[model samples]
Target: MEWLNKDVTIYDLINDHYRLSLWGLRCINIEKTWGLCDEKKLSEVIVGLIDSGVEAEHEDLNGNVIEGYNFIHNSRDTCDEFGHGTNVAGVIAAKKNNGVGIAGVADGVKIVPLKVVNKNGKAHIMDVVRAIYWAIENNVHIINLSMGVEVISSDEMNLVRLAHINALKVAISKAIENSIIIISSAGNNGEDSIDFPASLNSVIAVGSVGVHKVNDTFILEKSEFNNSGKKDIIYAPGEDIYTTFINNTYSHTKGTSIAAGFVTGIVAYMKLIDPKLNQEKAKELIFKSAHIISNHKEEIPFINADNIMISMWREKVNK
Candidate 1:
């Protein structure tokens, strides 16, 4: 919610926007990362970007996007309407160094776009559940969820209602059982809290942070809209981050949504380094290689993809 330039500032990072986007990638250390996995294995490593939709035909994303389903309209195509999914997708894997827009954290990986939300940016738990099952069936290595309940409630509800929420949780568990990493936004409400699926135990909840304009500093300070709480796991630069948008343009947006995308990208990078990486090991490496923010009462760490890649690459050599 730290929407400094809500209207104008929150535009796409296209038309040579990579120059402005270098900071976030540099912070994560993905600015210069170009790791490699086996071509055959890389082709099989699909990363699911679940949200409203994706502009799959966009110049930067078209090549890597594989067959994706639209649970919203029950269609085979997953073109974006609300623009969130496409933005998130670009952040995670927007065809790197294409002499166009910015590069995603895991530019080389294939993306599986799952359109769960409609044009209004709304998605039901049922569709979300279905999307997870779809991603699992398609053998996705990672599932990035940038949408979820605004808040979770403890009040007792009807059996049918509770069952729906439970069903989504169950799908998350099944994904974990399959060794798939599930990453979600911690919400952008700037509270000591987490949204529904993000609050779930198996999901890696990512919070948002703002980068100092001049000093280039880092901290786990919650964005005005970024939800926080004991359930928080990782923090990433989310405010006014530049990324791909609809119509092959670029824009800047804020929220834990983008933060979740950053972590998703990091997780994908970890997998690229080791195709057999499990959820726990991927999380461990991300947490261990992050920028530990001290003096912040809570011990949540911020992701530093650069350090992570260096350590991982070194380990790869020793192995």
Candidate 2:
């Protein structure tokens, strides 16, 4: 019924009977945010998703997305062709309770869809840098980067790669200095190292945690493809995540990219609670409010969205 503006002729809607597949939200304790904080301030938060692009006219994301730029084509047409950005955007701010598709982690948040990657889902590092600068100029509160370059620990970096890396670092620093919260995927290499940008300073790197429920109990496992290290990285539900797709469709995906989306949404919600919540403070709060998932090598932090909101709210009230 509400598919008038969607690009596709036939749009998929989440039926009432089968609307409970959003286990990713449940894994992060997202429902505990009910009656939690200042709901009106949510609209003040804007997340700049630097990826392929977004289907702004999708049935579930129509009103939630705002004007953005496409670096590949050097045009204003930010419609998604690679489909990664749509999925990430849906995870962060898909319309909630409109009785259509699945609910996003955070509600009332607008997304600025910055298309950095091309139609093949490949992007030059300079394009990503440009996107970050654009987000700073637009005054976005949060930036979600679901893409990164893989690096081998033993490999030698050439001058060009090093220059690109430096450019990205400078751009990210500028964003952080402007009080923007940057969340990035911790790569999907399944190695002991995190990828660039995600591994860069002041960026909140997110890894994937596979969630399993058995006999009314929730179990968390580190995803095999998720990059982990001794660095301060947080985990989120990424395996078999259900989210909005291209052409106004809904489907399941899995990766550290999806996990980073969850962190982005939670960080946006935290920003709504405390406008002064910067990158350092957000990382501190996320680490503090997280549920620990440990193994023999390390203790990973699985974010708890409810705890983050409650903590920020309490800080505001006590002040």
Candidate 3:
């Protein structure tokens, strides 16, 4: 609610629940049929959730929430003051097979909460830079950034470049070679270009797509909140999306933020399956496996978790 000003109706919430249920079913079928990754063993990979914070005590997230840090106040508890972080976290690693709430895209993975933004929905470049550096030092496999700045700063851009270089070097060095995948939201500005690091070549920029409730399929039309162009890499369910933890309880919200989180969850799942995969390979796999939907005869690539996992498996077999 901190980021969005609109209110969600009950109808939207029910529709989201329905779509999520279908998505969960598809994921289960994919996993069972292809042996994507051992659900029991996938928790070994630690993914860094860099955002406001996480509702660590949330019933659906408590078990998977591992180590966490608060760069905002430099304290221990990274409890989500704003509900955005919790919603993002839930998308990434909310415990699956619990038969309650909702299933995450990568429920098998572990999360390392990195609180870079404070409760007031504000964050500084220095804190974000520090958080990225900390993630690098801590051996976080994938970093999910659901927040961004209106104007790109030299220092912040430099930090993102540094993180990308370090990740590349680490991948090549073969020493502590964990691929650091950076996923960012393609800001809700609905401009011709995306924002900040997401616009950068190194980060995976995600746009949003609205799905029709009646058929449970992506609405081919793009939302005004979505950012487009070459920088806009992929799209996901972001409009009227129902996620865990509202302002205080639970409700539906919409933005490119959720789309980025959706992609982050898929990336986490990919990492779990092939821990040896490099960042370049991961990025390529995501793009290659995306479901290209046509909007007025124009192809719009959207995130496809099942396709990505299958492609990775196929690559492994071929090799």
Candidate 4:
């Protein structure tokens, strides 16, 4: 999908190329899923999107964006140059009622854009660590990381441990004082083990799932670039998923990135419902409510957002 310029319109693409109908089945199902949760009301929470950058002024992401920072260049405007971050951000909280483009998973939530990568779609380990520290310092309720590095360093691992401890402490304190949640993307390398941060016991590791045509079964699969393991990874819709606002245009990108955004949106909604919910409880809610899809029962596990949200609502009402 080539863009006319940096300010292309969704209507222009639709009228010229017919890109919207490419994934007709998936688009229809996504619309249905949005319709199911629209009545739940998710406007009261804040979520942080940690990635390359975001198009904060995009029509579908205007008022929903709160504040943003770029750790790559240490700037305040975390604008998208690689377009990956904008797509991930749109998945979490693209504004609704715009009557132009597609809606996000959590339309009402506020997005705190944290840019940690550069235009080449690369980020340094120190930059990511600083971004995490910044997110924690800023009291971000939920942080979504869509990027991953293959090699892990001691310093990086130390930072990961520090983030995990900080997350746990903050979550516990929040449960006792305020209530917060943290979510991270399960890496995109399709391996037998999980990566850092996501592999950390504190962060929620998210995996990818594809709707396979054979036998009508939804397969909890890993992306070719995802590192796999028996870590605390949960699966979400990740294969060939449609995201929003790329290079000032709309496009579909596949990775654990979108899946992590999906989970971030849900966690934001959950926080909105129960402000006192801690990280552990939130994780428990996600795991206990997730739909099981594995046959062996010993391999990695996956999650169904629709089911998990329903279960959370039921639990809330029961309580």
Two-way lDDT contest, 3 vs 4, winner: 3
lDDT of 3 by residue, 40-124 (tens): 7767778788887888778678778877899988887788887788888777776655655765667767888888777888876
Off by over 4 Å in 3: 1-35, 151-178, 212-218, 246-248
Estimate the lDDT of model 4: 0.65
Point out the higher-scoring one by lDDT: 2 or 3. Answer: 2
In order, the Cα lDDT scores of the candidates are 0.77, 0.83, 0.68, 0.65
Q: Residue by residue across 125-174, what tens digits does model 4's lDDT show?
A: 66666766676677677778776545355576676655654564454344
Give the lowest summed-lDDT range of ten residues in model 2.
Answer: 1-10
**Candidates 1 and 3: which is better by lDDT?**
1
Comparing 2 with 4 on lDDT, the higher-scoring candidate is 2
What is the descending lDDT order? 2, 1, 3, 4
User: Residue 242 of candidate 3: its Cα lDDT?
Assistant: 55
TM-score of each: 0.86, 0.90, 0.80, 0.76
Per-residue CA lDDT of model 1 for 174-224, tens digit only, reads: 998888999988887666778878888668888887754433533335466
What ranking emerges by TM-score with the best candidate at the front? 2, 1, 3, 4
